[model samples]
Target: MAAPTFTDAVVKAMKTLYPPELADSAWDNTGLLLDQALLPEGTESKQSEGAVLLTNDLTAAVVDEALEKQVNIIVSYHPVIFRALKSLSNQDPMQKHLLRLIAARVAVYCPHTAVDAARGGLNDWLCDIILSETKEAERKVVQPISRPLPESLQGLGYGRTMKLQGPMPLTTILKNLSRGLGDQQHIVLKDADAELIVTGEMDHHSALRYTQLGQTVVTVFHSNSERQYLTQVLKPELEQMLSQSSRAEGRVLVSQADRDPFETIDISSLGS
Candidate 1:
């Protein structure tokens, strides 16, 4: 028996779970970004046979970790290299990371928006989380807000909207949302209407207006590429792919250090 190469694992995984052609957004940069063969000499062997690191975003720190751990492939949920780079110079931090990964012989693969809109991907997982938390009386009605790029890609969309059964108290709704998101105090409740009018900086101090139509309370939740969902939703798929592949020993690991870059603070608490 022979160990499967990185390309082999990626091909099998893509065919089974996320086909880059079928899953990628028109503007997305999915599929293989960097190949091990393209790396500098004495970096690593051409064969990709090591642990796979799964991360939402690929940073220089992550590349360092991959080099230290001898990780051959990085399955970044978000594409690290987006847009055309005029040059790979030290002036640009992203280019620096690219050069680092290239030198380390690490292969980069990104699923990006393709995974978000996949049949049983991020958006569906997020929708399930919110719907699961709602009480029976809440009678959640969930629908995808973003239309699919093509008509054939039905049920594939970015965000979804859930209409509550009845008008929920603003506080209660906030609490439910907080619990669902795993953060209570840091949740941002903004009035979308006011956002259009007010040009200045608006924090938690800004008044929140809950849009309501008759007995139903409507709220929209937008996910900013949070990696937490990837750990829960994509892990099983990756594991299954690995098990089915020749390289059953190849492990699919979610990066422990990955987190949302932005930190939220409750401005209301500052006043008290």
Candidate 2:
């Protein structure tokens, strides 16, 4: 039998922890999206084991970081190949990055919504962050899985809603949000049907609609909402799972380049 490659180990650990079945497959393209172990068109296979790099997205910069670090696999939280592609071409930046990744034989895997929907996954972690100020709260799934899974994942869902123990001031919640997400620059934490809604994003009109209905909406700016979980939760979990799976020994590192694209600027400072 062939030795388990590093890519194989990472995939196994991801699937075991965040089963693809838990993902919202209708729109999400999760699991091993790239496999260096499969070998490219004309070249012989290179070393199949190296370090793991975790990132929220697989951009060209992240790819460069992966190559510099000589990682065998990247556990990106978002899929680079999100839309249906007719072909790969350098003219498009993301496609160019894909080609580059392929050339370097750096495999890519994404657990996107699986991580969100899995019990104790990103959504749960987000809840912990949002409610960390409270002594206790009742957290319930905002959307339970439509697809069935084993009993082990009975309550897995994509988002969480919490009923605070006591009527804590919203200012305290805002302070906790800023502290928890490490979003020092933005103080605009504010969302759900269950009382408040916290998400990576919400369109302006939708946010207005919810607010009009007396529900608070908090938008952490998509990738920003997901990035910290990769560092705090996924990194440690992958490390533990990798150690258990015995892929021999390899380092699991988070990418420094990965970040949310949107930033709120203080343009008034320009007047100075």
Candidate 3:
């Protein structure tokens, strides 16, 4: 498939898989934020043959990777264009990334909170990670879709909560979380009404408040909580679904340049 046709297929697949309507439009910017057709035209040599790059964030490194590989489109999990841009200049690092992609004709799409609210989406994946130790668990939405509710997505919503059939030790849960997110550090167990909360991050004060009320919030930093889903879940799905939808071979590649900016340092050893 040609690059344009391939990008169209990706946009379609993204919409079919994680509908933009499911996103929290109140704050999020979802869907195809950067369209090549709308942006300034540039030389787009067919390099990777309809390859789609997946990343948790659209950082400068991710943009460089996309351009180097000449990916047809980028399915960034978090939207790059979150706020209004008064100007597209080299003054801002983000605007520079956009400018480079525009020059290379690499399009960008973000699924954001849409993936969180969709059935079998990011939040659901998080639920699976939270319940990795449980043999079976009942899960439900913390907030259900209220507006423009489609019949197919009747029960799908933003956050998810799990109720286990049997009580599992919090230590056991943390162990599974380590295995799931590929990070063994920051596994702290306080308490929770739901017994556990596996989230990206929480405000310091809000987390304190929750803990005061006996709710444990497990934060694996922001992007760390979301990065694995691209490689483990979305990559294979995109390859299969995009191929079928386009009736042509389409590839989905997870960006190697993306990662959580935070790291856990052992100060005890550092000072020694």
Q: How does each model score on TM-score?
A: 0.70, 0.85, 0.84
lDDT (Cα) of model 1: 0.60
Q: Report clash pairs, candidate 1.
A: none
> Candidate 3: minimum summed lDDT over ten consecutive residues — where?
141-150
Q: How should the candidates be ordered by TM-score, best one leading?
A: 2, 3, 1
Question: Each candidate: what lDDT?
Answer: 0.60, 0.75, 0.75
Model 3 stretches astray by more than 4 angstroms: 1-4, 37-46, 136-157, 192-194
Query: Candidate 1's error at 219, in angstroms?
Result: 9.7
Give me the displacement of residue 180 in model 3, in angstroms.
1.2
Stretches > 4 Å off in candidate 1: 1-4, 22-24, 38-48, 135-157, 161-177, 191-225, 265-272
lDDT of 2 at 237: 91
